[model samples]
Target: MGDTFSSLLELGGPVVLILLVISIAALAVILAKVFQFASARVGRHGLVRQAVTQWRTGERNTAAQNLIKDRSLSAALVRNAMDAIQMLDQQPLSSQERDIREERLREEISARAADRLFALASWLKALDLVTQIAPLLGLFGTVLGMIDTFQTLQESGAAANPATLAGGIWVALLTTACGLAVAIPVSVAVTWFETRLEKERAALEVLLTGVFTAGSSSTVAST
Candidate 1:
């Protein structure tokens, strides 16, 4: 293991070291995100169905209470809207005033959802940067290695060994391989995270819409 690592370090040079660090960081982010999602259990379908049903039945506060009991993004959004309605109900405001309050509450819920989702997604960009740059760095190392090999050949002329030339070419090519190694998995992780995030956003939107229109709609269907 040690020999293989030493060989990689020698072949890829500083670019390999940089990629190594980025790989570690990407791994950390992936793990953190995985844990966050796992702990939150942020599923949209079931919770939205349950909450929307209660909302349509005019059990708004009860729905909010049930959802808020669980810690998830969709629940938080529904809770925010429901809590807003409760607060407005207590104010004895006119119809226009109540509408304005509901709108403001909706905005607040959206902002909070955005903030939470952004936090969840923020580290993904770093992983993406690693995925993008690692290959470029590897290519850079390859170019440097090739340049060194040519320089060595020019200086040595007839004395240059075939084995030495072959070694240099392989070493140069190693960086590209290393870059791809680091990039591929991170890219996969980024894609998976993006898929999960999009699902969460869709769920939140559906739930929020249900909450906002619970009064007008007779049936709240789950998506």
Candidate 2:
């Protein structure tokens, strides 16, 4: 395998080498993102929903406790909202003041959520760049190789051999193949990561909305 890879690098030249480096970097990023998503439990929303339900039913402490060990973005934001509302309840404020404070708290939590999502999205742009440029790099390599091959053939004049020309063409095409190989998988990974991010964003909005609405209803009922 090592020999085969070395031979490919020789044939593909610098373009292939650059692609190899990019593929390694892209793989590292993908692995790190996978670990991050797993540790943060990105799509695991059952616990978050249960906590929100607890909060909605006026079990503030229970809701907070349910999320004590949870590290998902949704859970964290919901917890923040719960804490803010609980603190607001303890404050001696007029109705207007309370409403203003609650609005500010909501905005703060939303901003924090946006920051978390942005963190989750970090390094994704690098992956996107790889997907976009890998193919072009490969094409660039092929074009360069083809130009060299034709120049050699022109030099050979009447002695130019068909077998040699065929060999050169294949060698010239290798870079394009390698470029597509790197790009196709990276594109798939980018799509998957983006889709998950979108889902998480939607989930965060829904969970936070649930917390605020539930608190308002409970307050209304009590008054």
RMSD of each: 3.5, 1.5
Those runs of model 1 whose alpha carbons end farther than 4 Å from true positions after fitting are 216-223
Q: What range of 10 consecutive residues in model 2 has the weakest lDDT sum?
A: 214-223
Q: What TM-score does structure 1 among the candidates reach?
A: 0.89
C-alpha root-mean-square deviation, candidate 2:
1.5
What's the lDDT for candidate 1? 0.81
Cα lDDT tens digits, model 2, 129-221, are 999999999999999999999999999999999999999999999999999999999999999999999999999999999988775534744
lDDT of each: 0.81, 0.91
Would you estimate the TM-scores of all the predictions? 0.89, 0.95
